[model samples]
Target: MSQLTHRVGVALWGIPLLVIVVLIGGGLFALFLAVVCCLAANEFYRLSESSGAAVSIGIVCAGLLPLVMHFRPDWSLYFLALGILVIALTLPSHRLENLLGRFSSAAGGIVYPSLLLSFLVLIRDGAWEKHYYGGMVLIYILTAIWICDTAAYFGGRAFGKRKLAPVVSPNKTWEGAIFGIIGALFWAVIAGQVLKPVLTVPQCVIGALIVGTVGQLGDLAESALKRSAGVKDTGNILGPHGGVLDRFDSLAAVAPVFFFYFKALGMV
Candidate 1:
């Protein structure tokens, strides 16, 4: 019944599934992400609807656009551009009112989880020479985000005073943010030590700071969406954890940042 209990119970079931999917990094991993994209797109459409926007079913199909990256990464841009154009052009005919609002929300739903999450597939498949090492990189990022989230949750509960963003996410506090960054720093150092050949100490520390900051911001962004929609959680798919979007919001933010960081460093 407690939040902590719900968190732990969900982790028990979810973590293993995640490990299995990440380990099997081919069609299986792509399929897993595709499924998540569908669920998240549905949640986003539902959220947009709550605001009186009429999202089209084609927008939901657009969620599958990112899976193209798994096979043809270069085509992703065209897919996104064309998909958005189609969604926009179709909107005027489908609904007579609030065309702009509906189009923007529909386009956003397609891009957010679908486009952002494709980076995970890219990371797992193209980031490194060895498949195993690529998996490790993905796992490292996931672990760092988990550390940050867990620390923030408890830290806020225990020592929170100043609210971070009272209007966006009333429960978050500056104290929690500080603790979360600290947790990320700690893990980054350990990870850097273990992956010394691939990552330097400085890189780890800096990456952690960037990831921690962006991950929290990503969480806040989702909170803003939920607040706008006037909902408590995205969906009931994850039980106490909310939904796929709720669980992966931080990941959605962290993945692109982390991937680009490695790419910029010529590591990827």
Candidate 2:
């Protein structure tokens, strides 16, 4: 099959199941996120390695330690994350030379994948369960982001005339962004209606805009990384769609933002 066919097939087959499993909310949901975190971290490590940063496979396990400690919020996962930070920073500056440069690369590894991705872990462990309402928020954030992406594609094709951030994602445009936010708001409304007892329309619209904007920013952030890496995409795992990181770029960064917003509203 062509790459386009491959891409469409994967999205069609995977997104529904993934969404349903996530909406169900339980050990299965947490486990699924853990797996996603693992894959994203590995992809980040791979990109870092290709960009001339050295990292051990053990770091993946080390990265997961924060999630484990998240069960006990009283204890600072920061300390464990900091420990990993120190070790990674201290990684023999002489191993591949450019001591300071290596240190910077190592730092990005921790920030982008490990620390940022851990917020979902915190959400799962937090006492957000008023009938698993937090799960609804999480689901909405992801769904809104996905809608943004989908809307961007069709909107760009149909009406895009100005670049939104050409340096980051050229195919994305102001027109597409407008459509994305609209699409995000549409889905957010649906989600709110579906979980009517849990969220109000105003809350749903605001949350969708917040997540959609943040998710788009996250996508741009990942794009910056890919630009730095001198690649067209993150990997080829999804054929024309790129790799796991490419697919989940916004999801990773948006998770933490959603956590923060929910906290401010006392939703999670």
Which candidate wins on TM-score? 1
State the lDDT of candidate 2 residue by residue for 146-251, as single tens digits. 7889997799889999998998778888998888888988887788788777677788888788766887888889988888778887777667888878887887
Question: For all the candidates, what are their Cα RMSDs to the real structure?
Answer: 2.2, 2.8
Q: Per-residue CA lDDT of candidate 1, range 38-116, in tens?
A: 8898898888882332354544555566568788888988888877887777777655687777887888877887888
Best by lDDT: 1
lDDT of each: 0.82, 0.70
Candidate 1: misplaced stretches above 4 Å?
A: 1-6, 50-62
Local error of candidate 2 at residue 137 (angstroms): 2.3
Tell me each candidate's TM-score: 0.92, 0.85
TM-score of 2: 0.85
- The parts of candidate 2 lying over 4 Å away from their true place are 24-27, 50-54, 61-66, 93-96, 129-131
By summed lDDT, the worst window of 10 consecutive residues in model 1 runs over 50-59
Q: Count the backbone clashes (under 3 Å) in each candidate.
A: 0, 0
